[model samples]
Target: MEDSSEPFAILPADMFGQVTFIGGVSVEPLAAVGIIDEALTLVNDRLTEFAASPSFETDMQTVFGESVDVDLGRTIIDALSLGEGLPEITVVPAEKMNGIDGGFDSLTGGVYLADTSIAPNSVIGREPTQSPNLADVL
Candidate 1:
């Protein structure tokens, strides 16, 4: 059985129409959806073009440890590309705001701040780090 914990879709398709806010700035709901669709289509086209090459499939299989599904690979690439673009889109309007700066960090998979510091060693709630064994609780 495939692991349920593992993510299947690179991007949640539903996110295309969802409201995304950054520093109180928001994208037009329809525009966001259109951009996501365009990105997906572009990535898919690129993948198909690459696959047309004689050795592309074999090369990908060898490097990735499995055969690549063109559709799935396109979705993954689109998702990653969209994630990279989001910071730029969100930060554009917010750039004029005082003391606000943001950009995507691919390596960390997060946004970083230049002039802010998070409170060190802050814990919001008390919770066990591990689940309790059912037998022990019983």
Candidate 2:
């Protein structure tokens, strides 16, 4: 059985439509599935050229992980190619606005992370956030 004392809760997307993980778990499955379905539906409704491949499965990929560089760019292009417009395409540089607290030092210095690097390309559904105020609501 799951640990009863273990913290578990579903984080709803903020006013901007972004959700995130909490207490060291992945995004909630139901919420995540809904969000992705909506994004895919939006892509189909809008772009009309995207389709989910047989192997296409929604999973979390790191966004704003390192230099705000290439992998991020490719993720965005792929997401777009799938015909979805990321709900929130922009976010403040996470490192710049806040300093590291020692545990996750990968994000030390501040850097710009565009939508291509921050949204569906890197991952589907919402990103875990420390505060809703920090996110730019779409």
Candidate 3:
């Protein structure tokens, strides 16, 4: 965020003074200042290409409402300090998945079943050749 004092300098002196006047019913100037400060902070943080666009003023005015003064957008642009244009972004392709033997099996979606043998200590025992009688068990 830029210095708080910097916004004061960008804002119109007469408008600021009006807001400071005692017993003044209107707070538009104060609200405008707050809007400008917030907008400046947002632009500085995001660094989006929109800040450099010519329609930035119209966009800001629309966001802050028609009642807001034009100076707000001007101040925000100055605070952004946008250069000639936004930098170009380059995307690198992702590395392909390497399956077993440094190759992928198109069939079965590359899944393979592991071989297993029964041991004496194994919890899963072999199935009985004959079907057990439920009556006898009961």
Candidate 4:
């Protein structure tokens, strides 16, 4: 992501193994997975080090603020950490689509939702539209 002017698709959950963590940059169906795959490649290499680091236990203690098992804490961090250079999804500052006029993709989901938030009215559909909808089908 790395913060771009380009529009990103707020894809369906099923697009990513039941949990869509990444969004497509330009509505290319594969963009989300592509990004995820790349990200996994990057982070996958670090998992061993992160897990083996002795100080990682200290890092865990710092995070938990209690005497929890260092192994468990390291495991959690190793599991959750997405690694460096994580792409920006531009989720923030968005006013989630919540109007009747705004359209939705029936094939993907029944209703349109911005979740906690979504792209603002102005930034949406400015140039290259990656909107996930089939107007004729709807």
Candidate 5:
């Protein structure tokens, strides 16, 4: 028997994957190693596309009228309100330097702002968002 695996022996770990035969010919899906990762990417893309599309409230109304009662529809609506699934207007606060200062502006980002009355806050990433139809509390 011929050593068909010799061709892939030099390939890197990421390039290695399961081999199959098609019509008596060898075929290799190099990316098969990360099928789960690829699936996650596809799922994320699908979710983003769905989010960008129009709302499904109209469809619900078309079927059950504009008023949804206490049921699966209502629950779905509530869950859908978990933010617009879009990016929020983030106001990234400045970080303070590590030092010992007893200045009066210590409260407001270590005197970074002229207005010391302001509050000091910082976050690693953008803040969470809410439904666009709802108030802009965030």
Candidate 6:
């Protein structure tokens, strides 16, 4: 006696009561929202910290000539895991820019040399992840 093709819908209050009280879930809507806001702040703090951190904390010398050819390609990696220190290095050639024209200085304009271990910083305040993580109640 029911329309078989019709979709089912529940009211917000009912859903909230059932999911939060009946189900005994840990997250309530407002609490979840607060947690999410805090997490976003944390992520922003982390990003700022990383950006402010030194690009190359240590200075190292790279050997090059007047006409140094550099390779440009994607390097392969394996076994990505957390807690590993990021790998980034700026390879400053031990050469001086004197006679070159219309080209970036190979010495002063030094190239960034990094291993693939570095992780990109997260963008701030974009995706709304709290909607799903939060409980129906609030």
| Winner by TM-score | 4
Model 3 poorest ten-residue lDDT run: 111-120
Off by over 4 Å in 5: 1-33, 59-138
In every candidate, how many clashes are there?
0, 1, 0, 4, 0, 0
The true-versus-predicted C-alpha distance at residue 44 of model 5, in Å, is: 1.0
Expressed as tens digits, the lDDT of each residue in 1-138 for candidate 6 is 232223122112211111111121222434333343343344435544533446312211123333333221001111111212212112111122132211223455322211111112212233465321111110
Model 4 agreement with the true structure over 1-138: per-residue lDDT tens digits: 543434444443222222132232223334434433443343445665767777776766787766879766566655545433222222221233343323345455433223222222222233345443211111
Which 10-residue span in candidate 1 carries the lowest summed lDDT?
115-124
Ranking by lDDT: 4, 1, 2, 3, 5, 6
- The TM-scores of all predictions, comma-separated, are 0.32, 0.21, 0.22, 0.38, 0.21, 0.24
Ranking by TM-score: 4, 1, 6, 3, 2, 5
Q: Give the top-scoring candidate (lDDT).
A: 4
What overall lDDT goes with each candidate model? 0.38, 0.34, 0.31, 0.39, 0.28, 0.24
CA lDDT for candidate 4: 0.39
Q: Which stretches of candidate 2 lie over 4 Å from their true place?
A: 1-26, 49-138
- Writing each residue's lDDT as its tens digit, candidate 2 over 54-97 gives 21222112334444454445566566555444342212223432
Model 5: how far is 88 from its true place, Å? 28
Q: Kindly list the per-residue Cα lDDT of model 5 for residues 1-138, writing each as its tens digit.
A: 242322231112222122221121122223322331232234344444543446655655677787755256545433434422212111111122133211233243211111111121211122565211101111
Q: Residue 50 in candidate 1 has what lDDT?
A: 66
Clashing pairs in 3: none
TM-score of 6: 0.24
